[model samples]
Structure formats: C-alpha cells, structure tokens
Target: MSELINNRQERIEVMKNLIRQLHEGRDEEKVRRQLESVLQEADYSDVFLMEIQLMEEGISRESITKLCDVHTKVLKKHLDLTETPDAVPGHPLHTFLQENQALLQRTAHIRKKIAELEKVSEEESADVLMKIRFLLNELMDVDKHYRRKENLLFPFFEKNNLHGPSTVMWTKHDETRSYLKSVIQALNEAENISQKEMIAFARLAIEPAIESVEEMIYKEEKILFPTAMDLLTEQDWYDIYLQSPEIGFCLYYPEFEWVPEGGLVENVEKIKASDDKIHLPTGSFTLEQLINIFKTLPVDLTFVDAEDTVRYFSPGKDRIFDRSRTILGRKVQYCHPPKSVNIVNQIIKDFKEGKQDVARFWINFGGRFIYISYYAIRNDQGTYLGTLEVTQDLTDLRALEGERRLLQYDEE
Candidate 1:
C-alpha cells in the first residue's frame, strides 16, 4: 500500500515471501490477491526482476526453472494486460509473431496427418508418412526461431536486468529441442511404419514436442513480448533488426521495413582506419581492395579453421547456402542436418588423414547446374590447416557453346 513497497528490492522480497508461502501450502487465492495488490495495469517485467533477484540470492536455478511456468499461470489471471502486442508489419515483434503462427499451422498439419493414420489401413498410412515427414522437417526449422531468441533477444533481456526469465526460458528451449529431436528420430527410424506405429509416434514423440512449442509461444506473446515492448527503446530495436540477418529469418520474413525515426540505417560506422593494408607473400592489399577481391570471386567461399570452426564466408553476389554470425563459433558438424553430419565427418576425416585433397558434389537443382566442393587447405610445408567450402552456379557456363572475343554494347 506504501511507495516503499513499490521499490523493486522490496517487491522482490515480497515476491520471494509469496513464492515460499505458496510452496508451503498457503492458499492460492490469497497469493493471487497479494500479486494483484502489487501489480499495476500494464506489462509486468517486475516478475522477471523478482526471479532474477531470487536466483542472485543463492536460490538454485533448477528451483526457479520448475516454478517459472507455474508462477506465470498464477499471475496470468491476476494481470490486467492480456492483449497481444500491436506490432507493425516491419517491426521485429511482428516477424516473431508471424513465425509462431506459421509454426502452429505446421503442427496442426502434423497432428491432422497423424490422426488420419489412426483410422487408416497400413497401406493408407504409407501414403501419410511422406506428408508427416515433410511437416516434421519443417517443424525442426523452429531452430532458427529459438536461436534468434536465445542469441539475440535474450541478451537484450539480460542487458535490461531481466536475467532469470531468459535463463528459465532457455532451459525450456532445450526441453522443447529434445522433444523435437525425438520426433525427428522417430520418423527417421520408421522402416515399415504401420498405422499403429504412426499413431504411437505421434502420441509419444510428436504430440509432446508440439505442445511444448505451443506453450512457449503462448508465454512469449503473453509475457515476454509485452515486457520487451515496455523496456526496449527505439535504438535497441534498431540494433536488434540490424543483427537479425545474422541469425536468419524464421517462417516469416517482414513484409515491410521499419526505419527508426531520424536514425541512421547502418551499423555504427566501422571505418577501416586502424589497419588499412593487409600484407601477404604476393604483395600487400588495401582493406578495400581485399574486400572487393573477395566480392569479385565467381564462387561463394566459406573458410573453416583447424578447430572445425567457421571463420568467414564471402559475401558474394549470390550465395547457395546460408551462413550466419552465430555459425562462427559453432562446430562445423552442427551446420549440417542430423543425417548429412556423417558424410561431412567422413570428408573431414579423409582430409585430415591426407588421403584426399578434395570432395565434390554436383547436381541439377531447381533447373540450375550447381557445383559444391570442399578443398583441404594446407601450408607450403604440407601442414594441415582447415577446409574451404566453395560453391558455384555453372548454369550459364555450361550453356555457353560460343565465345565472345570482344566486349560490345548492343542496342537496347
């Protein structure tokens, strides 16, 4: 009732007491009443602050993890603000909301296919497996969504002193990730998958994962987005948008661009003033010159170090595979799918053993001739360094039967 209780420290203490009481068999209604007295009619990030404080006071993280969703349920009905955030098309929040909607649709399709299999004969179920597999594959693409939240958005929450929510949610992310993996594995292992097998996998693996994902989306839209909207400034959002491309987009890409009012549209200027020239054995190249050289290359190149870490990927005119800053420190094995990981490993093994200098894959993809190669990098002394992945589209080159001796301008 007093302003003194409104102090965040005091509120956190009250929160701790309330949580303890609730765990000690106090009446749920009374606890809800206590929350009602403290919360104003708005987004409640104080809940985040309270949990962060409790964890800082030596409470185990696992303890808070278990109570996160439970306490959110308790606080849900007591809060006045239950409206979904109003994010414009170009806004980052809108993109996330769109992705969640897409994920829900994919899950619904998965469930529907599984339901159809329940009543169908084994032959009929056979027809459903391909559809189920496709949907499940799309669902695994939720990784991009989760990675963006964990790497990009969560850091902002931590910066704004809302540490506990991010930590707890990250734990839940892992749980959902495990569930997703199980579902994928189930589909992968299915041999003659009967109608019964389809039903069983859906119930045991797919259903639980889908439920967890949907629940997380609910919590995020209800609590996380609102709290972020209340806390982050325009510049904070601009920084997030600029960095988002590094994590890649989820199911939905923004339909419009959001420009911060009176703000510069680029990253804080990073002039190459500190080191203008890069010296090499051949000669020296200016920073600008070296950058242009990489851009001028006809193929896309990604360099992986001896540590199996992605160091750099050239930004060419066109790229065949996506690379993000998040991939910088990630193991090369994880960059591929769960199945192709073995082939990748084998290639690396062959290279490391000096048995092979190159591995290549060429295919006709989407009516284009695509060539992919991995070359083992080594020093003049033949010491193993790393590997370089080079990809090129040779569609035009393959089609060229005649050569142009001179450059000539033709009338348009």
Candidate 2:
C-alpha cells in the first residue's frame, strides 16, 4: 500500500475494506496496522462516508451496530488524533461534551465505590450498596441525554439523508439503556443475596453499563460531532439549542447562554399568513381568532403530533400547569418527569395501537383537584393523527351541590 493515499474514493474503499475485515473476525490489531496509513490521514467525514457506503451496499444496520464497538477499538488511535469541533458555551455540542464530563465523573465515582465494596466488611457492605444504587439512579438521567440526541439532533441528519449512522447509534443507546435497567434491577433485588453473590452481580451487570456510556462519549467526540459539524448548517444547530430545554440536561446544565452571531429569525411568511382566514368544512377563523378561542376555553390544552412531538399549547389564563414556547418542538416524553415518562409512553403506545382512545386521571396538586384527560386525535378515516391533552382545575366543580336550569353569571 502507498504511504500517500489521497484519492477520496480510494480512501473510502480502504476504510470500508477495513471495516469489513473487522466484521469477518479478522484480528483487530492486524487489520488496524494494515489500514494505519489510510486511517492516519482519514478525517471524520471519511469515516462517515465509509459507514454510509457500507449501508448502501446492503449491510444490515444490526450488523453495523454489532460491529460498532469493534470498529471503534480499531480506529481509536486515529480518532483520538481527529480534531473535535469547537463549540461555545450553551451550544448543543458543548452541552453534550459537558454532560459527558459529568457522566465520566459519576462513572469514576461508581467504580471507586465498587472497589470499596470489595474492601469493606460485611457490616459495611450495605452502605456501599446504598451508594451504588443512588449513583445508578442518577445514571438513569442519561435517558434525557440520549433523548436529546435522538429527538433533537438526529432529525437534522435524517433531513440530510444521513440516517443510517443515527439508527446505528440509536441502537447502541437502547443497548446501554438495557444494561442500565438490568443493573439497577439486580441492585434493587440484592437484599437477600450473599455478599459474594452481590459482588458477582455488580461485576456482571454494573461495569458494562458504565462502559457503554463512556464508549458513546468517545464516538460522539471522535466521529459524530465532528462529522455533524462539517455537515450541518448554523441554522440546524440554532434550532437544536432552542429546543433542548424541553428534554432538559443530564448531570450538567449550561450556565453560559450562547447566542450565535446571526440572531434568531421568525418566519415572516408565517406571520403574514396568520392574517388570512383558515377555511374549515363548517366555518372559518383567522389565526388570531382561533388562538383566542383556545385561550378562552376553561381547560388547558396541548397537542402532540403522532410522532410525539409537542406541536401546540393553548395560553389559557389559569393553566393547571405551566406551558412554554420552548416545548413546541420537544418530544412529549420529555415534557413529563422521569417517573411519569413510562406512563406517558404507555398512553401513546396504546393510542397509536388503537387499544385505547382516551386516558383520564385526576390528582390533588397545590390544593387544587385537577382533572387531566388525553384523547387520541384521529382523522376522518380513523388514522391516528396525534394526542390532545385537556386539563382542568376541577376543585370548584367537585363542590357543586345543585345545578340551576338558567345560566347564572358568577361574581366578578
């Protein structure tokens, strides 16, 4: 092989061949050495192109995902030499790196605790186990981190027809999530197990979970971030930055506000179109009138699209819960706390599957009895369109003693 491998197509083929060798169980170190000259000069885009081309050639995404770690192992040296894209404070990439730093610190702490478990006596093992559970609980926050990537960042890749790698990365995210869940469950059920058994479980379940997270950080900084920086426009990043708050941050949050040199722009055409009347089968209303009608309704209303993105929320004067514009493009799962996300997912799942159409619940919050109902929005042809959430403060309604036939106005 020549020392100077300059042709773009040749570089791609060499990279692809190396990855194929990895898939075929070639010795990683040997293959790496063979590809050293080519990889030494390969940048992040070249690596991305290699994966995309492999996918185009009918390589299964599952196969690529399975080989992803092996690919990383072979490419780690050159990837380390690859320059990371610089991002200012509050930029999405900067925030992701910061979260990775926090996650690394947490994983280090967990490893130290695991080591301490070995040293501590049986009398002290309980305390060590407790600390590990607490850390694992915090580690679960990584779901928000991954959700931000899948929901906020990956869409831009899809728009660019660069969907394969994102799918592969998402598969890895699910794998990490499974490991975290299994470890957490094993820890939760460790009460009756022997100390030796507990230690074995820790080794079996915990270590892999932490390593999955760390490996993802490596992939992001080395390949994904740099390639995305090369491919995505400034506007794409700006949109991601704005919508990130809906999902929130992981262990870290950005304190510094990042404003791009180019300011945020509103869609002027949309604003102009708002003045025109919207025609419906039965009636017509200007956008202003439509908005006012929603605001005047007694219940707070939010509409999430079929894809689970929050698309609209009514600005009622007395909403049972707060609503913000930041949530407009956010995923519905992130709108709820971690504990309730499972229920939210279940509701959407049932709605989409047509197992159910409406879910209702009532809770006493802040001394107010609030009634919440979720209706699956569907089209005339019975196709699921999205979900409509209607929330009302039912404290006064629950106290009603009698009803009057005639309408009566309450005191001002």
Q: What TM-score do all the candidates reach, one by one? A: 0.69, 0.66
lDDT of 1 at 272: 32
For residues 1-412, write the lDDT of model 1, one tens digit per residue: 5665467667667778887676667888888788767664323666777778778877778888877766777787754366778887777888899889988998899888878887787787877877777676667666778888898888888887778889998998888888887777666666776677678877887888898888888888888888888888888787777677666665666658776766455434342354687999889999889998998898999988787766788977667767654455445765675557679889888888899999999998888899999999999988879999999999988887877899989574
Cα lDDT for residue 114, candidate 1: 76
Worst 10-residue stretch by lDDT in candidate 1?
A: 265-274
Model 1 CA deviation exceeding 4 Å by range: 1-18, 21-43, 56-58, 76-81, 255-257, 265-345, 348-355, 361-412
Candidate 1, residue 264: the lDDT equals: 54
Total backbone collisions for each predicted model: 0, 0
For model 2, give the 10-residue run with minimal summed lDDT: 263-272
